[model samples]
Target: MSADEGTTPSPLKPARPSMTAAMRSSSFLNDHQQYRPPSKPDNHYGIDTVVEDLQASSINSPKQISPFNGIPSPENPPTIVESGLSHEYTHPNCTQPPGLTTDRLIATLFYKSTSPRVSNAVGPSSSPPHTASSPVRASSPTGADAEIPSNLAPSSSFDTFPLEPPTNDTEPLDHIYGSYVSPMCITSFLHLMSTFPLPRGSTNLTSAHRCLKLDAASDHHPQVVELTLAPAPSQDYLSLADLRKHELIYRFEREWNIDVVLRSDTLWRRHPRLVVFDMDSTLITQEVIDLLAATIKDPPDLAARVADITHRAMSGELEFDGAFRARVKLLTGLSADIFNQLRPVLDVTNGVRPLLRALKKLGVKTAVLSGGFLPLTSWLAGELGIDYAHANEVVIDEATGRLTGEVKGRIVGKERKQELLLEIAQKEGIDLEQVVAVGDGANDLLMMESAGLGVAWNAKPMVQMEASARLNGESLLDLLYLFGFTDEEVAILSKET
Candidate 1:
């Protein structure tokens, strides 16, 4: 080509020297020396070039980016700065990918970018380097809402493109509930998202209300981020079939201790009207029946026997009512005065008072359904200002003012708990789907199942697996986060007490 043809470009170089020859050389130029002529400047950029540049950087730099892309591949890896994001995660037991170089990883990230943004740039490496003035592509959906007319396209950053929110019909809204996802993990998450094409994110960071908008710096809890995930092209919705996306989700959870719950955009789910808690281990740390039996000093081993039965019932070993009734029989002659001693020392579970107070301030109805005696449950309801309280009534022999060794009313067993949940929801004029149940035992399973959301709080493994959600966190306040309240909102509500 002549100087007169300067406006046009020269023939491009071959894809590369063979992998064998390229692998033999350390620097990119060692094998592909002819591609960049010594006589000229060039701007030809491709995924392979991106790969080579990152590869060379990895080889020469002291720290490798690591296989999991700095999800802290080991117990405590250093913060990795790549592509303008600086975040580090320490997933102490997260499984790492097989050994892969940065080059291959970049290759994995862009292998799907077969569009003109990639193929059209394959001219001579002898052209001017990429610049702000160079014609660039915008990665947004092209349609009637296109900001730039097709005739006047301009260069834009990938960050300039906003990920579109999921429509009600196509992709449902969901949440990733974990304390681990930070701004830096955005890159890894984006990479995982890119593995399956996602709708673009927002360019309006200034005023944008992310699905979860938290001021992490000021928030005591890790900020909740609203995530909108969709099925990739040609893929069936995961609700109907197995989802490969969950693989990445579970991986992140395993490594970073995150729990991704796919919640709907419905109002009832995020802001339920009623929340029922089991009194024994859920609302309080101790089992009331076991405590009641412990006060029977005459039979030194009665508490031990009652506790064993209570444990078995909670673990689902024995029938709930049978075990409960047998335990009451052990409490046979204990004086009614025992209730006075247990009341003052009743230990509320950590985060219970604050959570109940917050819920009350928000006007969410709260209830305590217990298989234990009604007196303690009612006292708890009064103390916490809960709306409803239901429990078995201990039959006391009025003549002697001593225990009758039986319950007077209907047993508040698992089945009864379920019935009461629906009954209360109806009485409150709330929908059945607008109630939440929290418990820590097998008997609570049916009641939990009946509610829209069931949280197994520090429960047995079976309850954890079967419940709609589980809260193994240190406090119950995190539930408010799942409901989409921010730090300020939570603080304001939790202070009502």
Candidate 2:
């Protein structure tokens, strides 16, 4: 029955193969029977064979044809398929699906690939041999065909990119001297004034007489008669009591006057080598601890306590050890991070830049022997270009990043300040006679006393009285005169600065 049916064409022809199945079979045959050039000049003839025959020949043959060129060879030339013009190629058996575009390919190469071309230039073997066929990705943002926001981009936008000048006006002003100041100038001026010797003998008495006589004559003048004056003594001759009363009046006027000290250019000509400075209320206008307290969150009262301790210490009412310990205790649990955060807000005193600049020019080996924290003091020293600096370090908790409420190293007290001053002088190979110390508070007495020259700048009554020279109503530039800077030199500095 099957023979008869096959012989007599069936009503339905053999079920036509599905289009997909036919295509698949055709592709398979084409791949298997694909024409290959001869392997060598000896085997140059092309052989036509069916799929089965070609399969048998391929298995038997020791060499294959060159896919690149029509000529056959013993070495098979690699098959390089130009898949597309999209700057990407695909590999066979990459079964992880498709639809990857050029951009994705480039990004994947950048982030994932570590081939020679994509290797970091900063690597140990920086200069790798270049392969022409190896794909090179652009190293700069501009060369990339992608969008990136300005702020989100790296500061160095591109390694090879050109840089433009700053556009804003504030850029230049950022470097000006108004940026930072040192507090040493005033303290030094005040200390100097205190030690200045007064004219001796009855010169003081003669000055008193001149003031009294001037007053008496002014009282009798037609212009003076209209003005009020002490009643003319009823007796023609003056008694010792009258002279004493007159002397007291003259002395009161002299002491109270704002311009009490005379300006003498000669006095400043004598130069001083060593200068010592007080830290708080001297070099810097504000007590660092007090300012630090104010910056603390949620409590304002702590700032007051810090200020009190600072005042007592400066005035010598409390021993430095007791005051410093008490103050540090108040700051226990404070974060070390506060120093960095509050540095920008610290108030640098006025006239510090000019003073420090002048001192530096004079070849004075400047130092800051402060009672403040080392971090703050060191920062100031670096900023001001001071040669030497010694200050106490605040002990900080490594884990919690908080202050331990204790100083880590030596306490820079009155005695320590003096010691540092001597140490610095000895190290610099300078004698004490070549040194000058300046400070505004009682804590600075030891340093001031040790220096050959001591100046007080806007100091307390006690400090002012003890200092050898006092500077009032002048910029710190005047200190240059004390270091032998002439008017011409000062003018040149002012211009250069």
Candidate 3:
């Protein structure tokens, strides 16, 4: 059989009308379609239109072609049925043309909708299915195949690709997956996902958990970590609450100390010379008059009078002279011998010895400017090796050997304290800058202000607010450092004392 002779006669099938044939046969085309020699093919089809037409033809063509088999009949032309009934079918191995796979279709649609160039780089695999053994299967109409579990099936391929889990072994205890399923898988997923570049460094569950942990541990939140020690311009100017918040734990010689802050270097470098101390509640723990009164007859009444005067004088409410005079008049005719009897009961302030001893060795002259009487001040000066003592002298009549209800010298009021400081400075050839004053009373304000450095020692509120420095938590020995004394210097001073 020759090729032409062996060919079967074409079947004489009934004509089925085509829209193109009908349109061409009409009056419109009869006039327009007169055969003219075709001009050079007009390049009128747009690039996009040509591409789409080529894609459509390719998609409709059979997968295999053979010359021995005549042109395929329309009924038998390789049928390209979608994997599922709907266009949204997903079944592995189902036949489809190139670029019609679910992934490609999704990507193309996404690129068209968003106008972004879709990159072809493969992203992380979806999280392993809950039942790892049951593999997923998906297929496009064009025969493209993909396997993804129903649970792992992507909502859309245009969605962000999944990330592998972290491999961190030290996972949080509260992790839901870590509590139940394979920890190994969770760890591996974390490690793989970490490599993916996420928008804000969080994509997978593990990274989200890590981010939360980091936020919890931040310094902005109140955790029990040591505070950052960066220097601020003004340490002394902080609010009371802020001062307490950043309080430092310090180790001095043989002592563990906690305080809001330490004085700056400049304060100690320019150390004061003459030190003035308030006698009661500052140098000594107890008011000597109150102790003396307790030892005297009608102790309760005398103690009450002494306390009243002390409170008023300390608060800056009553003039120091008026309060002192009133308290002294109550003690008038009380024996000068009472001080000797009550001297044993007097309690010196803590660390007073080391403080005074260190000051003396430093050639820092010390003074006790007290609202307390002269006799007590003189006695304390001798005991403590203080260089100067200015206090209210109780006038005692020689005939009676009892108080005469008068102060002999200038009253040790606040103004008088300031004056005495100036007078002592002049007498000793010392500048006011060479003076260190310590006090606990409002009456001490003038004296404190007069000295170069004023220390408020467990002071009243007014004094604490106004003083150059305040020492509340540590003993008087702590003042040694404030004077630029090192630990070794303190030890040496201790030995000398």
- Candidate with top TM-score is 1
What TM-score would every model get versus the actual structure? 0.56, 0.47, 0.48
Ranking by lDDT: 1, 3, 2
Error of 1 at 300 (Å): 2.6
lDDT of 2: 0.51
Please give me the total number of clashing residue pairs in predicted model 3: 18
Off by over 4 Å in 2: 1-269, 297-299, 472-474, 481-488, 494-497
How high is the lDDT of residue 275 in model 1?
96
State the lDDT at 259 in candidate 3. 20
The all-Cα superposition gives candidate 2 an RMSD in Å to the true structure of 37.0
Candidate 2, residue 212: lDDT? 9
Which candidate, 1 or 3, has the higher lDDT?
A: 1
Better of 1 and 2 by TM-score: 1
Candidate 2, residues 1-497, lDDT tens digits: the string is 67877695549668875667545653564478667544434333345444334544433455776565455333543344566534323332122235621110000000001111122222122232223422233242233233322211222223421334222111111122111111122222233323322332211110100110011222221100001111222223543224223443223212221112221222222556666676666677777888777766656688877876676566555788778878888888988988877677666666677677766766777888888887888888888788787888888999999998988767888788888888898988888877877676667778887886666655654565555544442244444444444445655655535
